[model samples]
Target: MPTTRNFRTRRRRLSWPLIAGIIMLHLAALYGLARALAPDFTAVVEREVVSAFTVTITAPPDPPPPPDNQPEPDEGAAGDPGRDAVPQPVTGQPPKVRVKRDDPLPRASSTGTANQSGAATAGDGTGAAGSGLGTGSGNTGSGRGGVAVTKPVHISGSIDNARDFPVPPGGRAARRGTQVIVRVIVTPDGRARDCRVYRPSPDPEADRITCQLVESRLGFRPATDANGNPVAAPFYWRQEWF
Candidate 1:
């Protein structure tokens, strides 16, 4: 039998372009299928990605100093009302009015006898004793009075918290001296539940943004009552742009 040589099959490597083309074709087919399933794929709203900035307003510069040599204005003198009036000569004998003389006090007679009954009583214009009001205690009720409920005390709330606001594009209505006052309603769970613009800024959008920012960033512990019970309360804070 003659000897025969066996050769192994050679493996070929794919070119980068061919590989990229295959990948692109596969992606295209997948995209077509996805588009067919859902035509309005892009209609879903997504969270906007934006850069945030903390805004603060700088205090206005101190007013210019007054001139050192400025003359002080003198205050007007107060005039006496009677100074200009001339006294009328005795006003015709002072109008002749009669004054009644008080009569002398009556003297107690020696023949009058003292009260025969010996029961003692006391009264200082208040009332008779035990007539529903002579007791020293404040209230007439025998039971102790109820404690008064004072206003709720705020345990924790950020009044001066620096908040982050998204910087809008093109700087529209983002000028200085703009401020918005927001009222945040804090629940008993120490969370900000609702927010509304208490005082709106010049720009309407600024007022809306103020509420949104407060609802997301602001945190507060509910106001506590005199008995330390947590309650829902509104907290006001201001944000200004500069």
Candidate 2:
């Protein structure tokens, strides 16, 4: 019975120590919870103290125009405003020209009239002497320089491929003849000067070939005077095919 009483005293002492340990554990848990839920004073003060600002922009007003009394610059005046202030005068005068008159002829008198009458009478053989004097014997009713004028002589010829006067291409068919009237200017030296084809063929090819042939091959003997001398006379030639 004494042992049982001692065991109950020891249980009471152990129960008091356990109660103190439980109380210390509960106080530590409450301190951690309070620290976790509390606000950060330094971060709150920094965020609250910062500030932001907004700005607005505006355009400037235009300046006033310049005065009108100032003279505007001239592009062609080389920066000098008074350069065109001078006035110019014009002079008038007539152009000079030289003039001269022909000399007057001598006046006719009775003596001069009589002399001219005698000269005319002698020339016509109506003077006292019935023979005409001071005249050329060769002065007949012929042309100038005593050369007898003859009529224009006409000559005719032909341009053909068969005869080959101009020698056509070999083995080619002979083209039909083209008649061309050629007028030739006969010079004083008996040579042809200006030879022209006055009339051409109806066919272009025939006209070209005929004109070329006539201009190359045709010639003539000049006409003769009464003295049997070749004279400067006109002539003509005709080219045709039968």
Candidate 3:
């Protein structure tokens, strides 16, 4: 009878590893099915998982610099309106002029003619009338203590048959005429001092006679200095004898 009871006396135990394996296999199959149904499902799940652990922060940009500020110039208070059109009176002191002791003093001309210094001015009418520069009925270079010499010395030589020269006979002067020039040094008193033949004639006798005639007949008005005083001057006298 015991042999006839060949029934199973051993009971099978529960396998926990097989059950965990089966559950993992089912999860993998479900993931595949989700990828097939919606392709972006895995990506969305991974983004949500990362966002839960990560923190993000943003900052604002800086502001620009301030602008420059400057004051404008005033136009109403610039300058005077009539400054350049009208001449203004000088307010400063005049400059000093230095003159040496040896330098001559400047004097105004009394003659009616212009001199080296300045123009002529009218004088007191006393002498002969003058012509040219200013209106003055007076002689020039005749004033005492004048500024400059307005006129030079003059020579007067005239031939007179009765008082002057006598023609030489039987000479070259009588045939072709003889020309003679003499240098006469005049005194301050208007008299001849030294008379010498400057240009001689072909005839020596004519030269001698001409010089003698110059010393006697030639008259001169003496030259005046800057002070209007008479001064000695040289005169060249020329004459022709027939």
Top of the candidates by TM-score: 3
lDDT of each: 0.58, 0.51, 0.64
What is the per-residue lDDT of model 2 for residues 1-242, given as tens digits with 9 covering 90 to 100? 55544343344355877989999999878766665676475456446666333345677888888867977777676653565666688787877776876654445555453423334322433232323432221332112233435643435444545454343444223433546666665533445545666787454454455556555555545565676655545555566654
How would you encode candidate 1's per-residue C-alpha lDDT over 79-118 as one tens digit per residue? 5577567877774566767899775433544443543332
Sort by TM-score, top down from the best = 3, 1, 2
Candidate 1, residue 222: CA error in Å?
1.6
lDDT of 1 at 170: 54
Which candidate leads the pack in lDDT? 3
Better TM-score candidate (1, 3): 3
Looking at model 3, residue 100 earns an lDDT score of 64
| Candidate 3 clash pair list | none
TM-score of each: 0.31, 0.29, 0.34
What TM-score would you give candidate 3 relative to the actual structure? 0.34
Better of 1 and 2 by lDDT: 1
Count of backbone clashes, every candidate in sequence = 0, 0, 0
